[model samples]
Target: MGIQTIPGYMTRGIVVNGHGQRFINEDVYPGLVGIEALYRQGMDVWVVLDEEAFEDVPEAERWGLQPPHVAETVAELEKGMGLPEGAAVGGDGAAVFTLGGLATDDEGRVRDRDGGPIAGPYAAGRASSGLHGGGYISGTSLGPGTCFGRRAGCAAAGAQQ
Candidate 1:
């Protein structure tokens, strides 16, 4: 829908012509959601990913370089990941592609270095309950303030409870 220029490259696009064989891109923004809908309509995808697209996101949330064929192999999982009667792995098997995932628990909840809760779901500076940081542990290198923040909140909550 718009064009943006990064330091190195510029992505310029426009509504050239809308009609297609049977499918349309629907949205011009690279960050638009529901990619499978386009797939369902027989449109093969060509994602041109780069750093600026993921700049604001936490490092853990980014996918570095999954093989190009990974999406092809995982195609069955895209449409709900469930099988008709045989059961399947697409619908609920650690599924990892959705729009709201950035704000939701897809990247896992943040917990403290101890077995305590930290900031809820910041992309950074807080510990994680499920996801691992660049360090060797599930919770490390994050700002300790987040852990104490939860502690104080928990104390207040306990007093009220």
Candidate 2:
């Protein structure tokens, strides 16, 4: 069963795949991204948090959550989580997911493989591939989108003129 967790659940700890090794950034998109990593490792992963990081989490945020498998140190956390000894883990399945989007021009116009802009249809924000060609940057999921969305909208509006 999946747990509704606060973002802090990720920012504070490290995440490891089924093999108990760090794969992607702990704070990556936080959903499909992390899940994909899990699939890559072995489809079963764990989050190991040290007592200090666990305690640092706010009580309110932990609301309605299962008590974390407690451990005083990393080794214990790994053992508790059934990971290999000394395995570093956290946010087992929280990294956000990102996929390559429709290729777009600077004006947010979708382009074909031949680099020709597709007529009429346009994309912006995460829907457009320009901002994040292969990967994404944290905290940028929205800003560029808003800006590009506006540009696309304006361009679309003018094209209708």
Candidate 3:
């Protein structure tokens, strides 16, 4: 799962001397502002994917996370999703540019202009889900398929006690 623009959006950047660290920062975003700020701290992000539109939108009206920066558009975002640039395949038909914006109509059910997932849309995480023996690593979230057999076994053992 990627980070969204809520209060505690998960981030992974370096802590430099003058950079904000959430609590002490006075700006809306406490960490690096953008790629420049991140690079200024001698750190490079593999992919800068974070949910935007993190405003006062209601939970039901909200689709998914918005793209924080204007430059972090769909075209510049697919590299983070393991897709080729201007990919013309699933999601948006045969000609999709970016996979990172929320292009919705009055109904809020269309792919974003950049071909990214719209708000409230359910999208598969861009990462691979295959483990050595179906175990979670660092980045995987606790989804449904992640752990069942082991949990059921543990539950059965506990019930016996």
Candidate 4:
């Protein structure tokens, strides 16, 4: 999903699998969360938040998912949600895009192992690692992709000339 859902996971809570088992550290970037959710939990995940944590989330940030199930305690919440006795929390990941890409130069030329640009070929967007590294922030992809895509086109054309 978009950055709007950041507040949901970045809450004063923990993320767990269907079995009420904690998985990834909730403090990491959202991209890391998505990776962990996809690979480890297979997207079967939940965000366990106490009342204060739940209240802190604004309605707009909920991302139009079904309303949260509230209860007097974690066990009750878990029961109501049909999770294992202790699994008391959650969210559905909308999308998990690739994080890193091929190494490239400023002009969008692909880099060789020697750290020099390869001739004739150029790359950009998610196809080239222009700015992103281990973590991801929503909205960071589009701008870099657009900017570097243009740079790559220019560089490719210049190389042909």
lDDT of 3 by residue, 1-105 (tens): 222343333222211112121211212233333432344433322223234433334565445655444345656544444446654223411111111123333
Candidate 1's residue-wise lDDT over 1-161, tens digit each? Answer: 21222211212111111121112232322333123323342233323333444354344544353213122332332332221323322232222321121221223344443535445433323322223322234334344436544554565465456
In order, what lDDT does every prediction score?
0.31, 0.62, 0.33, 0.66
User: Residue 42 deviation, candidate 3, in Å?
Assistant: 38
Give the C-alpha miss distance for residue 148 in model 3, angstroms.
44
Clashing pairs in model 4, backbone N/Cα/C closer than 3 A: 46-90, 47-90
The stretch of ten residues in a row with the least summed lDDT in candidate 3 is 15-24
TM-score between candidate 3 and the true structure: 0.17
lDDT of 2: 0.62
Cα lDDT tens digits for candidate 4, 55-105: 666767766643356788767878865688644335533333444446798
Question: Model 1: runs farther than 4 Å from truth?
Answer: 1-40, 63-161
* Model 1 pairs whose backbones collide: 80-91, 81-90, 81-91
Q: Estimate, for each residue in 1-161, the C-alpha lDDT of model 2 and write its tens digit.
A: 23234546655765565456755555544564445544565556445455577678777777756545776676776676677775553434333443434778878788997899999889986666323423456666588778888989999999999
Compare candidates 1 and 4 on TM-score and give the better one. 4
lDDT of 2 at 155: 91
Report how far off residue 150 is in candidate 2 (Å).
Answer: 12
**Model 2: residues >4 Å from true position, as ranges?**
1-5, 88-161
